[model samples]
Target: MSETPLDPRLDEDPYALQKHLGFRLTHWDVDYARLELPIEHFLMNRAGIPHGGIYATLLDTVMGYAGCYTGDPGHKKLALTLSLTTNFLSRPIGHVLIAEGRRVGGGASTFFAESTVSDETGEIIARGSGAFKYRKTRL
Candidate 1:
């Protein structure tokens, strides 16, 4: 469950990559974010399972958002990822993937976040941590 509903502004001007990948922002708060993706055929690898890159993408997006939340809908904080590391924990099972991220620690200019991707059954598919630098301007 999420602490807050996703802001409509997110879908109103979605990121190109997020829109193309078909993941939707599900929740956001001061130091947290969540995203969900319905598994699609195009997202699978030749072996028929969801691709590793898909997991990585979800982890990256969620972790970045965890540190960039701003309460105001008219203004947005941005972060440039400095580094990201993902660990594949287990194969996901089910039709949907859920990713949740939390900001762990940081200063004004840089921050750290950790995230997890889980299947519909709540099995963790991957875990990730990242470092990001806040952008100077708001979006």
Candidate 2:
């Protein structure tokens, strides 16, 4: 048996922030996407919990990917966020954080998506929704 190969684009993601944060694209579909991150002590805040910025990033990235997926997972689409709203619920202390995104609605040029972040133990850390516009050309 062999593991499925990773999307080469992931190695050179246009979003430098994702590469800097070591985000892994675990799954993706036409209207859905999931990203994962292993807990790192350095990501914690003064309260010893994951920073809100981290939560916000998970939400934004996941929801953006949900909008980006065009049918063929191999063809990566670029979606720019027009607006994003996040609601932080709890703090994550688990070894991993999982973010799942689902496309809600929109038309040809734009899209809407919602996403949730949870810990390995199934604790929801945050939820978010966003509006995104597809780029006219590929990056």
Candidate 3:
């Protein structure tokens, strides 16, 4: 994970909700983007673990970033998700969640991406994939 970031804004993520939830970009490259979501008490359920919705959100955000990147900060690719699927693997316990996403395949207008989310201990808690259309727009 990188300490200092080039930009916190992800082209695929233009919503204010992500920042409000304490999501931060930890790593980014030509192939992938990694994000970290804080595991605050409010994010937990009665079971004392973060809710599945939180994991799903992180996965989707990272995966969307993966497919929409053009390797240039000034020029960005925007993608709208067409389909998304997530699998909850286990219950995770930690102060934060680490998510990494990569582009799997696609073409000029559409793309596929896969994302994995893990706890602070590096235990995978969820996985997801998404198909998106690269909307010809820049943010």
Q: Best by TM-score, which number?
A: 1
Give the clash count for each candidate.
Answer: 0, 0, 0
Q: Estimate each model's TM-score.
A: 0.93, 0.86, 0.86
| Position 102, candidate 2: lDDT | 91
Worst ten in a row by lDDT for model 2: 1-10
Indicate which candidate wins on lDDT. Answer: 1
Q: Which stretches of candidate 1 lie over 4 Å from their true place?
A: 1-3, 9-12
TM-score order, best first, reads: 1, 3, 2
> How displaced is residue 25 in candidate 2, in Å?
0.4
lDDT, candidates in the order shown: 0.90, 0.82, 0.81
Instruction: Pick the winner on lDDT between candidates 1 and 2.
Output: 1
Writing each residue's lDDT as its tens digit, candidate 1 over 1-139 gives 4456777765446779988999988898888999999999999999998999999999999998889888787787899999999999988778899999999999999999999999889899999999999999877
Give the clashing pairs for model 2: none
**Regions of candidate 2 where Cα sits further than 4 Å from its true position:** 1-15, 71-74
The superposed Cα distance between candidate 2 and the true structure at residue 64, in angstroms, equals 1.0
Where in model 3 is the C-alpha error above 4 Å? 1-15
